[model samples]
Structure formats: structure tokens, C-alpha cells
Target: MNSFAKVITTLIGSFTLLIWVGKLDPAPYPLTYPSNFGNRISIPQNNPTTQAGVYLGRNLFYEPLLSANNKISCGSCHEQKRAFTDGKVFSSGVDGTLTSRNSMALVNLLWARRFFWDGRATGLEAQAAFPLSDPHEMGQALTVSAAKLRQSPKYPILFQKAFGDTAITVNRITMAISQFERTLISADSPYDRYLKNTYKPSPIELEGMRLFNTMPQPRKKIRGADCAHCHGGAKTYLELFHNNGLDEISTDKGIAAITGMDSDHGRFKIPTLRNIALTAPYMHDGRFNSLQQVLDHYSEHLKQKHLSPFLKGSSNKIGGTSLQLSAHEKKAVIAFLNMLTDTTFIHNPEFSNPNHP
Candidate 1:
């Protein structure tokens, strides 16, 4: 090639690179702090998340085209209401086939060391692929999904803007969706304001908080239950997987299914209590109906065999055996749980499905 043509090509390429960097700059938002749940608002070093990428991802997340039948989307199962968890005991899949377990809420997952009750997927990028191609979920293989996206006139344009080119790959799809999902943080609960000391909790709520943070004891009356061992801390959250005696013999041996270890049987990931009021039908199976019921399950139950050794039955509080409150203490604990509900995060426009607009 002539020197003149080479010079022209180099100049054009340099100009294009400069333009790309300018377009990739992120937009601004309010100050965000690392929550107890352990996720950061900023993008990772290698991925270098972009606003355009997150927006494109938000659309794909709600789009039905990812499915072979083009009938179901991720939003179908992880709806914004019910705290991003399907209220159904088990989410219905693409072909109307049923899932094995209830859908878990998408809370502060940045801090989580693992994902899913079975702990199969290790990364959020990896997690998106599971439901997309699962025979029961999105029901489309990555190759099939790529074909659908490539054929879509709009998706090609979206993909080009989010990525460098219009070519769609499974990695880009997963990474973008993970970027959007990572922004699903919740922190403006009543409890947050109380902790910040901007507002004071009610008398009953204060009493409940007192009981919740106290250590477990077996012989002292007029004492609080040791509820804080799993559910307390600055984040007021724990990435715990507890057997919780959900069943006398659990049909679902949670983490054990992921790892073929006998001791891991029946253990499920401990969920963040942030917005606990909105997330109902508690536990791995969604068996307990209310916070009061959950409290009762922990208190009235006799054995702590598989329960974290730090936890003992509430023996000092009511009947020298368990949290045998006069129904009043039980009621107060429920009230404290209510403080964790974050309404702003639930209805925030940013987290809503972008395609809905």
C-alpha cells in the first residue's frame, strides 16, 4: 500500500477510537455506599460496565425473543412486585412445566459467595444463561437465541451500541444482563433511617430491636433471644445456608444437591432481610406464611441440631425453654422486621423493565 493510503487509514482509526471512548463515559447518580449485603455500585475492572450496556441489557431482560417460542422473558418469573420473586411456590417454566423450588428474591446479591439454592452457578453472568436456555425456563439454546437476536432489526442496533459491533454473542448477552441486575440494590428502609439516627423507631419497634440483637440464653427470664447470630450486622444480612429444620426430613436437600456432601443436606442460602415485608412465604420452600410464623418456627421449635451452633432455642425469654412470649413479644419481633421494608426500591423507575416504557 502507498504511504498516503496508510496515513489516511491510521488517522480514521484513531478518530474512531476517540469517539468510542467519549460515547462510553457513564452517567451520574447519587452517592451509593457498599451495603451489608456486600455489592458495589461501580462496575468491575475487566468488564468496565457502561450505561449503554445496562440499558440494552434491561431491554433484553424483558424481551420475549430470548425464548424459542418468544413467549416468556426473565421478567415473567422475577417480577418487580413480590420483591422480584414469583409468589408462586414454584415458578412455571416456558412450556408450563413447573420449577423444583420457589423463586428466590433478587436482593443484595453482590455480597453473596454463591447463587441459587443448589449453588450451581458461581457468577451472575453465568446465572443469566441458566434460565435463558433451561428447557423449562426460556427454552432456547445459546445458538438459537443468537439467531433470534441477530435476525431482529432492533436487537442488532442495540447490540452494536452496547458492544463494539452488531454481532451478538452469549458472553455479551450474559454480561450486559448481569450489569443491569447488579444495579438492583435496596437500602432506603425505615431501619436504615433509624440506624442513621435521622428518625427514631416506635416504642414497640425499639423493644423488638432490643430482643432481636441480644445473645441466645437458656436459663434467664426477661431476656432477649439470640436472633442476631444470623440476621444481624451492619448490613443486617447474612449469606447463610441453613437447614432450618424446614421439614422433619427435607425432601429438598439444598446445597447437598450442588455438592454431593451429606452434611450439606437441606441447607439453603440465608437471605437478606432487607425489604423482608415485601418478600413473603419465607424460607427455601415458601412454606411459612408470615414473619410471625417464622419467628414461631425458630422459637417454639425444640431442637437446634443442624442450626448454626451459635443459635440455641430462646430458653431465657418465656418458658425457660423457648421464646414463649405472651403473643406480645412475638408481635413485637414482627414489627421490627417491618422496619426493613424499602418501598422506594420496589417502585423505583430505574429498576423497572425498560421495555415497559
Candidate 2:
């Protein structure tokens, strides 16, 4: 080969090296949340959110190729319009099999340590795998999903941009998905506006807010909804599990299935009320179709033999006798819950399907 041939080969090698290096450094994502949202988010050091990673994750979230039949995606069951919940009692999986529980809303997940009603998954990265491979869900093996992503004309470049290489592994897939999920913050509701002093609640709604935060003191004639014990503060939920008296003997073991402790029986993770008005049917089983039924259950139907201590009344009983909120009071409580619906979140184009206009 001549000197000119050697120079041309060197130029080609340099161009290839530049292309590889160009994708090595993804820009940091501009992550922001409500200032009043309490403690700083605990982002995993290994998978810090990046603009490219979030973009890849967002596309992956809506990509039907992730499922077994190439017809379903994470976005199918967790539609943005219903605050990321599918609005079905139980979401239909890839094979049209029904899920065991209602799909959860994926809002402000950065603050949550546990995933699922049973709290089986310890982190967001681990949580993504369950639905993808669950027999009744997406029903696709992780290896097969990775293979499909790798074969895609677009995913290799996306993986290069997001993970610094074109290696389409399950870990990278989940990490990218978790990055997109962390951006789903819902702090622009009417209730949030009321806290910010930008919006005024009506007389009934204000009364509802007061009642919701107030502790029930039946002996003292103080009527309270006692909601804040499980769902309080700026984030609207305590990151803990509780037996909210859904049944006297719950057929589903809930957190107890994972812990194998009798005390944890029927204990389910406390979900956020940020967009409660839209995420129905409610509860782990999707038993209730409306917020009114949920309120009624707490007010007059709590029946778990071992209810959470927070639900006990002045007499310290494990029954609904503790909270017999009046008809008008129940109405007010529902009004307050409705205030939690953040229209801005559901309509936000940034969180919508990137493939759609």
C-alpha cells in the first residue's frame, strides 16, 4: 500500500473513533420538581438521569416492541390521561389475560422506595422487569425483549446515546425506563395550588381539606376523616404498608406474601392521593369503582380483624366504629379528593406519547 492509502485508512479509523466517542457522554437531564416537595430525591449514582437516557426511556415506554406480541407497551396500561393508570379495574396483558391488581399510577416515584401494592420491588429499575416478564402482563422474557430491542433499526443508536454503547441489555432498558418514570411529577393540582396560595378552594372544599387532615376524636366530638395518617404531607403518602381494613380475612396475602409474617397480613403499600380522583377503580384489588365507595368503606365498612393502629378509635378497637363520618362530611372529603386531580399532568405534552402528534 502507498502512503496515500495509509493516510486514507487512518482518516477512516479517526472518523470511527470520533463516532464512538461522540456517544460516550450523554448530557445531564434538567431534572426539576416542586420546591416544597420535602427531602431530596435518592437517584442511583450508576444510572443518573440524562437527556438522551430519558428520551430513550420515553420512547421505550411507548414502544410496542417490548411486549411479546409487539402490540402492548408500558404506556398501554399506564396511559398518561388517567395520571398513568389504565382506568381499567384490571389491565389486560399481552395475551388478554387480566392482571391480579389494578395498575398503579406512576407519579412522583422518585420519593418512593418500594414498588407495587405488595412492595415486592425495592427500586424502580427492579420494578420495570416484573410487568415485562409477568405471565399475565407483557409475557416476554428479558432476553427476548433485549434481542428485539437490539434488532430494532432505531434502538441500537438510542442505547448508544443513553448508555454510552449499543449494548441493549435488560439493565440498561430498565434504567432508561426508570429515568423517564422519575420525571413524572404531579404537583400542579388544585390542592397543590391551594398550598401555594395561587388558587382558592370553595367553602366546601376548604372544609373538606380541614376534615381530611384532622384526626378523629369521636369522644371529643371532633369529626375527622383521618386520611393524613397514611397519606399526608407534600408528596401525599407515607412510604409504608398498612392494612386499611379492606377485608376481615384478605384472600390475597399482600405484603405478608413477601414477609411471611402474620402481622403483615393484608398490609398494602399506601398509595399517593396526588391524582386519586382519576385512578379508579380503587385499591389493590380494584374493588371500588368510585371514591365515594372508598370513603364509605372507611366511614362504615372497615372490617379487618387487625386494622392498622392508625385506624383505631378512642376505644382502640379494630373496627369502622372509630370513623363514622356523617353524610355531609363524606361529601366534603370526596370534594377534597377531587382537588387532587392535576389536569396539567395528564395534558402535559412532555409526558405524552412521542410517536403521536
Candidate 3:
């Protein structure tokens, strides 16, 4: 061939490569959260959030094909209207098998380093594998699920758009799901609006907010609900685990099951109260059916034996002494808890099932 012909061929090959690269390159996803939520998010360097990846993850989140029976999806247990909690005492899995614990609300997960009630999974990516493989949950093998996605007409193209290839792996699946979950930020509740001076709280709600933040000083006769210790800050909960005085003996063994340390017994992850009003049947075992019941437990029913130090207070009088809140005080506290509900989050179309109208 002549030198001019070879030059033309090289230019044609270069053009084809550019087209291929353009087709595979994913657009960066913009994550928006309240400025009060702080600058840190738990996104991993390997799996940065992208528009194509989040879209793929959202579809996979609602895809029933991930299960053995091809019926239950992650969204089945984590419904959007209920702040991603199914409002069940125990979420039913494939074939009507009950999960060992209640379904946790999937909100503002970008700030969480640990997942689950007992903190079994270290990160969101690792956490996604638990339910997919748990016998009582989705109950499908990761390899089988990957094969199913590979065979699907739509998933291969999605994988290509998200990860620059058509190959589907368990790691990629979890990464995509994690990317979508990180976008589930909820920071526009009444409480948040109150913080921003955009919404005026009622007199009782204002009192409730004040009471919720004040720490109890029994010795000093300072009366307060003392809720801010565990459920405080803009996120409404600390990223640590605690016993919370839930059980005197701790039959389930909570975080101890993972850490194997006696000191960690009865400890569970402190969940965010951002949408606490919507996430009913609170606690690891779903023991309390109402916010009132939860407050009653804290005020009058905290078992002393394995109570967390934060709940113990400064006094030495059996550690788990009641806060002795009056009927009016409890009502005020419940009102404050209700202010955490964000209606905008529950109805956000971006987080809804892509297949639904």
C-alpha cells in the first residue's frame, strides 16, 4: 500500500477508538446534601458515584431477578413511603421466611461506615451482599445472580454504560447499589427547616426540641429527656454502637456476635432519627411499636445490667434510673420526634422505582 493510504487507515482507527471511549464514559453524578451534614461522605475511591451507575443501581435495587424466586427485591423490604423501612416487626423474605431483625431505614447512608443493627458489614458495598445471600432473605447465590444479570438483555448495556464494559460481577453490582444508596440523603425535615429558620415550630414543638437537647442532671435537679447523647447533631445519631439498656440479659448477643467480646454484648448500631417518626417498631428486635412506647422504655423501663454508659448518667444510683418524665413531657418529646419526618424525601421521584409511574 502507498504511504498516503496507510495514513488514512490510521486516522479511521483513531476515530473509531474515540467513539468507543465516548460511548463508555459515564457522566459524574452530583450529590447534594445539607451544608450542616458536614463535608465528609463515606464514598470509596474505587466506586465513585456516577449518573449511569446510580441509574443502573436504582433499577437493580428494584429488580426482583436478584432473588431465587424472582419476586423479592431490596425495595420490597425497604419501601420509599416508609422511609425505606417496611413497617413490619420482622421483614418477610423469599418464601415467607422472617428476617432475624427488623429492616433498617436506608437514609443518609453516605455518612455511615457500618451497616445493619449489629454492624456485621463494614461498608455499604459489603453490606449489599448480606441480604442477597442470606437464606432467610433474598436467598440467591452471588454467582447465580451475576449470571442472571449477564443473560438479561438490559443489564449488560447498563453495566457497559456504568463501568466501561458489559461484564457483570458481584463487586460491580454491589458498587452500583452502594452508589445509589449514598444518594438517599434526607435533610429537609421540619427540624431541619427549623434549624435553617425557614419553618416556625409550634410552642409545644419548640419546647420538645429544647427538652430533647437538654441532658439530665438528676443530682443538680436539672430535668431533661437526655436524648441528645445518642441521637444528636444534624444527622440525629452518632456513628457508634450502644447497648441502650434494651435488655438486662441480652439473649440475642447483638454486636458481641460480631466482635466476640463480652463488653460488646447487647450493643447495637445507633440508627439515625432523621425519619424516626416513620420508622415504627423501633430497636433491633422491633420491640416498641410506637414512639410513645420507646420513650416509656427510656423513661421507666431501662434495664440496668447491660445499659450503655451514656444512658447510665453521672449518678451511681443503679445506673438505669428512670428519667421520671411527666405525661406532658413524654408528649412533648414525641412531638419533637415527629418533626424529624421529611415528607419531601419519602415522595422524591429520584428514589422511586424506575419501573413504576
What tens-digit string does per-residue lDDT give for candidate 3 at 1-357?
Answer: 999999999999999976664466578899987798897779889999999899999999999999999999999999999999999999888868798899999999999998999988889999999999887899998889999998898898888889988899999999999999999989899999999999999988988888798887766666788788788888897798999888889988998998899889999999999899999989989999999999888888877788887677532123437676878888999999999999999999999999995
Clash counts for the predictions, in order: 2, 0, 0
Worst 10 residues of 3 by lDDT: 313-322
When 2 and 3 are scored with lDDT, the better candidate is: 3
**lDDT over C-alpha atoms for residue 323 of model 1:** 55
lDDT of every predicted structure (CA atoms):
0.74, 0.87, 0.88
Error of 1 at 234 (Å): 3.2
**Candidate 2: where is the Cα deviation over 4 Å?**
1-22, 314-320
Q: Which is better, 1 or 2, measured by lDDT? A: 2
Residue 85, model 2: lDDT of: 94
Collision pairs in model 3: none
Worst 10 residues of 2 by lDDT: 313-322
- lDDT of model 1, residue 139: 89
